[model samples]
Target: MPTAVPVAALDPTDPDAGAVAHYGDPAREQRLLDNAAGLVDRSHRGVLAIPGADRLGWLHSLTTQHLSDLAPMTGSELLVLSPHGHVEHHAVLTDDGDATWLDTGDAPGLLTFLERMRFLMRVEPAEVSADWALLSIVGPQTDEALIALGVGPLLPPDLLAVPDAKFATGSVPPRPTAVYSAAALQFGGWARRMPYGADLLVPRPAVPDVVEAAGVPLAGVWAFEAMRVAARRPRAGFETDHKTLPAEVGWTAPAVHLEKGCYRGQETIARVHHLGRPPRKLALLHLDGIATDELPARHTPVMLEGGERPVGFVGTAVRHYELGMIALAVVKQNLTPDSVLRVGLSTAAMDPEH
Candidate 1:
């Protein structure tokens, strides 16, 4: 119900209720994201602080990721599933020495579930989204921008490696400004080598100064959406719903550990992987340039060339700078990659990127 407010200094106008869609020129902002560093405000995401001696172990037993040995300053992704093995929630996790933070889009729902599951455990989960701010520095100039802001030298080489030697040598940086390795935070916030960038999780009050100090142009959700779609990453609420299975969206490889101990949806996941294929598979649809002037709406029916019945529905569509008009969709598994499809009167070519 609560909407995120943009930083006052940015003087951003809302394109949607309680959110800044872009800072005037979306195309230019997207161009900056592709070539140079661009600062993006991600305070709308959910942040939860989980603290206690049993925190890691408890979370490991509940989610899809293997978190028993997750080290401080390292990050990983996990999925919360329904009893029937459908994806209920998705989270990006990171741990500081003191507390493990779970960042998700569905913060309120995740908090409620975590609380109910903590009947007798030593772990304590609290929603701390309001107390912190999340910002991302994306593009080729990410390292230069961080160094300019005095947030260097970034986290060590092996994120999963034991910290005993580093701690013994007194190599760990002090709090606040310590840089986390982009490899560790792979899911959303942190940078990737191919994409080349990093994210900053800072205190809420420091947002204005941090954004200004980074000295980069700002990008809004529109640009972020285009990049994410281009990368073929599936996001909660967009590419997934309560009844969506992890395998259907190609999340099992990253988010779910097949050999890990049993969790809520392990049985169904194992069965699907070993015994059968998902009924549908995620794909990228390239919209025909001359088919229509308007972008298709979310959940618009997708139909095959000769079929009268719809085969699937569109999830998220964006006008990518390089790819033109592209959309992520879940189509029937039997649909061939080259098959042409229709959404309304618009035509699209299926791309099996996932």
Candidate 2:
């Protein structure tokens, strides 16, 4: 994919792929969380555009999230699972009335699966990441900020699942009214994001115009990941293993529609939530014992303190501006939060809320 024009001016020698990790500011996290005008180059993220008459219903039958009657400009998430319920694909999508855009970390893999599943559907899935660039500005005032530039106020997904008064098994609940909408511009559009921000989708050539006019602090992935990890947001590669169930990482609360009809891996999801506990659970680890900046990496073994056997592994690790050294970890479902845990050699405590 061609680099976004906004950050294409970055020094090629600076690593972290093409996204401008930081511009000499270690306090990037603080500035962003404080609602500083922020610009993040998320060009590395992938996008797939599916435009066809049958897009909505066709997708509704394949993923975990509900979309059979998804309203225009509303955003929601979905997951493609193995027949056994392993999370094979995850994407946050938005419907622009005409086409549905699937934004994900692994677009090629998602695209391949979609192509195969399009056997007789009217949907045509194509990678649009190259044609479009993704950017985000996270904060309370993000809506007004994007409006000034004429991009979006992308509608955020319903974070808290509210059941209908008369809801029952296999019933579709009433769709909630959207409080936000993406701005339509000749160059591109914007979509509200979950947990905390708005996503900007624009053609590559329009990148410089948006970034220059954004007039906000330019942050890197470091700050974004810090916030995400702090919020206990479970990402695909980080928190999901081949056997991961939606219930394991709290995704079911936000991403799974319990009443949605059968789809791939629905059996496993149903069986796990109502019949049995997931084999593992997601947790936040506070590495209070760490004495240095050096932290454990992804896939690092996590064990009960003073125990030799491994129970789980660390996912995303970050040293928050206020929380100090912390990491999101996946551990045995039976593990107690009060129990001491070890991430590598550092002793830590688990927060079971995740």
Candidate 3:
């Protein structure tokens, strides 16, 4: 998904490298959420397809979601945790009745694990990202914007649990790789958590067609990330470390099914949830001290204002249209919601709303 648009490379090693930072006015791009839709290039995200009769059952047993009775055309989320309960892989999925499609950013490791665990199952996991790309239209106008593009109506929002049409549905299955206009965008998507938004999965070749006809502002990875942070969503690699548990990031509800039979990391999740507390918790921090255009670097140590040691590590930070400057960080679980912290030169405080 190469773009001819202006590039906003934070650095050569930025995860969002080769992405558009903004289309002229970065502020205007951020404002898309106020009342309009903003387009984001998420093509770099991985896409996996598991097609077979046993796909659902196999997934049900291997992961956190109870997929055995998953319904077709519904979107859900799943987690592959380490045997000790550490979060391993997370993906938002949809069943189109023919094959289950996974839209995730937790890559190579996720694919490797799925491949190795398929010993005798009647399922095949293949990386089809080269042929497919994920493009998202976020904000309140997302529905209308996508509809205008002829991508069709998106599936009612569904994410972590059974499909209730509220952006979460943990149980589901898939279908042919055809149209996504009305039936889950034809390519399939687990609706976005940012305000009101939708993900558009399209063929790699048709990206230009869709972008050109988007009829909305084209935002860079920066804007999209800002929105995600405001949404309190945790991305895998960024918000997680090797020791991260599903509950540590407020992910269990949307990514784990507590009543499910069994999976690799079930015990850790159960023990922590029922018996104790996670050592850390995900926190959204408002960095009022930061430059309006700057964000703290990834993994930057965050400190309590007068404390000597680092209390947590901040993930990616971004400037939001309304939220100002913010970032997600993993910190001591007992840290109070109103605790004031510091990120470099920025004075930070936990967001009370999230």
TM-score for predicted model 1 compared with the true structure: 0.83
Residue-level lDDT tens digits of model 1 in 54-163? 89889888988777777676666788999999999998777775678877888999999999999788998999888776777777787777676765446442233223
lDDT of 3 by residue, 77-163 (tens): 788988899988888776778888888886577889999999889998999888888888888888777677665456555443323
- TM-scores of the models, in the order given: 0.83, 0.88, 0.85
Stretches of candidate 1 off by over 4 Å are 1-16, 153-196, 289-291, 352-354
lDDT top scorer: 2
lDDT of each: 0.73, 0.75, 0.74
Better of 1 and 2 by TM-score: 2
Whole-model lDDT, candidate 1?
0.73
After superposition, candidate 2 runs with Cα above 4 Å error: 1-16, 34-37, 151-157, 160-180, 289-292, 352-354
TM-score of 3: 0.85
Evaluation by TM-score, superior candidate among 2 and 3? 2
| Model 3 stretches astray by more than 4 angstroms | 1-9, 149-152, 158-196, 290-294
* Location of the lowest summed lDDT over 10 successive residues in candidate 2: 1-10
Question: Ranking by lDDT, best first?
Answer: 2, 3, 1
Query: Could you say which candidate leads in TM-score?
Result: 2
lDDT of 2 by residue, 51-127 (tens): 99899888888888778787777777788889998898888787889899888989999999989889788988999
